[model samples]
Target: MWRSGSDAGAIAIGVVVEVPTPGTAVKHPEALGADLWRTDEPDLDEPRTGIRLQEIRLTSQEGFLPRVVVKADLALSSASIITMPNGTVFPLDATQANAMERLWGLTTSQSLPALPGASEGQRKLMSHYRRERSNTLRLKKLAEVRARHGKCVCALCGIDDSSKYPRQLSERIFEVHHLLPLATAATPVRTTLDDLVVLCASCHRAVHATSAVEDNYAVLAGHLRGES
Candidate 1:
């Protein structure tokens, strides 16, 4: 996101992921006047089928956006870092071992792509990897790092998650939501941890919980703003 604080005018750098296209738009349940997660009857067993990572290609987001931003990758993927045309790379540091601490919040809560009537346990059963091998933590770690470094905020609901909970599913659990909807990965957005989030699971579901039709651009716009 464009940094918004004492240095609000600063041009923050990010990692470029995939771009969006015509064939990869997600629809908003609220836009269509529908409740996304069915709050009253929260389905804990809802299955989130399909591997979103396998389809990280862009062919439908031509005019959606020209470019996007991400926090930055200075560790494992450091080999892929390159100098940009504008002389700025994400985290914008090439002479250092690590750029800067991420500027997002932290939490351990996880979320999955909602398949109507499908349960979470069932989705894990259908996944390619071993869900029990730290599935929840692994799937949500990137955003967790973002949240930990920055401030703990609900990336989905635009609310801060600093408040401690009484240990209940309905109480509190910080989350990191993907703005461009990483499931399709064609929205011209960056993949740095900053682009994800520290949202609550309930809010994260409201993200992909929209519809199976066109991608929700509004959510994307307001999604990753609070990060570094």
Candidate 2:
């Protein structure tokens, strides 16, 4: 939904990107990493739009609909289209009553953070929600690695967990690392198996601790081999 004033050519001051399930509460909108775009000419038939503004990140005030917050005061152009996460797009005419229907429909998935002032049980539930989401992806990546390599080994340190530890504990030693850090992404990106690498717990921690390590894994590998 978008907001406009009573003017012949009312500029859309802001647009709301609703949660997948309307009225679903989101405690941490920042964690979503959602981006909003304003387009002058939007192809209603296609997901593509002529972008008028740089993507702006969305933030909320612990409430129903998250609001758009931009560094500079940016307003949607007349007859503009707003592009939101999960492939949601809205075509808006400044002169007409703003009517929007979900075009180019796609499955919307939401991952919310723990609510504020929640009971211990509620906190645990949210914790599990996050863990399960993360583990699902991690386990899939690990499975693919094991399928091709026959064992889970660290890409950096070259530690074969199966050989060093018991079968049950061995799987816990390896972790999935993103070559491109999700936190640094400007927009939501589709992460494929190629974007992930397997790393031992120690090497994973070391890669995160050192700056510029992801680009040059050989540096960390050298350190692990006592060459650095």
Candidate 3:
């Protein structure tokens, strides 16, 4: 049953980027040698990881959803590295680098401080939810899935909430989860019936809160089914 909003338009705002530990004596990039990964840890100086905002502006388009754009310039470290929500880390490309510079020029000069260790709440701030599926589409998809599966059960764990909980509360405990990472969808698209899965509240939370399940839903489903 649809209870609230959809994940179709969620935008990733901030992403974690590795920076030299604050307060550490500055070493020439070449002097630090080829192994840049070793510098990611907190040493005597900077103890915090950098969380930088990426999407700086939103503009509505005719016949299309609003476009989300990243800042052209960065006020933080000059390092071009950025970590995405899917745990992919890569150096910013030339276009992104130039964009950051432009954004920096437009904003007030300010010091970019290292962010404190991530708390659950702080981590959540990295995402911004916008568009979503309509109630009509959601209900239709749910019906189609139930028709094909024969019943509503957790796609991850195969647990049926209707059988486990009280009749009045059981149906409300199940939710539909989007298969793809919502943050990657820069523009709105129709969410097909195949793009969603039924899951109990607990399993849905696990699939989202933990990287293992979120990264590969099929693998998790197979493991739960004892096939892997």
The numbered model that scores best in TM-score is 2
Candidate 3 global Cα RMSD = 18.1
For model 2, how does the per-residue alpha-carbon lDDT over 41-154 read when each residue is reduced to its tens digit?
333232221222212212222111222321111343222332333233445453322221111111233546767875442111111111112445677889988888888878
Clashes of each: 35, 0, 12
Candidate 1 backbone overlaps, count:
35
- Candidate 1: tens digits of C-alpha lDDT, residues 113-140: 6768856432111113111112243345
Tens-digit lDDT track of model 3 for 1-228: 001122211123445655644544443222222232435643545444444445432222211111122312243134323223233244556665555444333334445466797433211112343444444545666677678777677777877756678878876777878787665666445566688777788878777776555666666676788888
- Which candidate has the highest lDDT of all? 3
- Deviation of model 1 at 86, angstroms: 48
* TM of each candidate vs. truth: 0.28, 0.42, 0.40
Better of 1 and 3 by TM-score: 3
TM-score of 3: 0.40
Which segments of model 2 are wrong by more than 4 Å? 1-134, 211-218, 225-227
Go through the candidates in order and give each one's C-alpha lDDT: 0.36, 0.50, 0.51
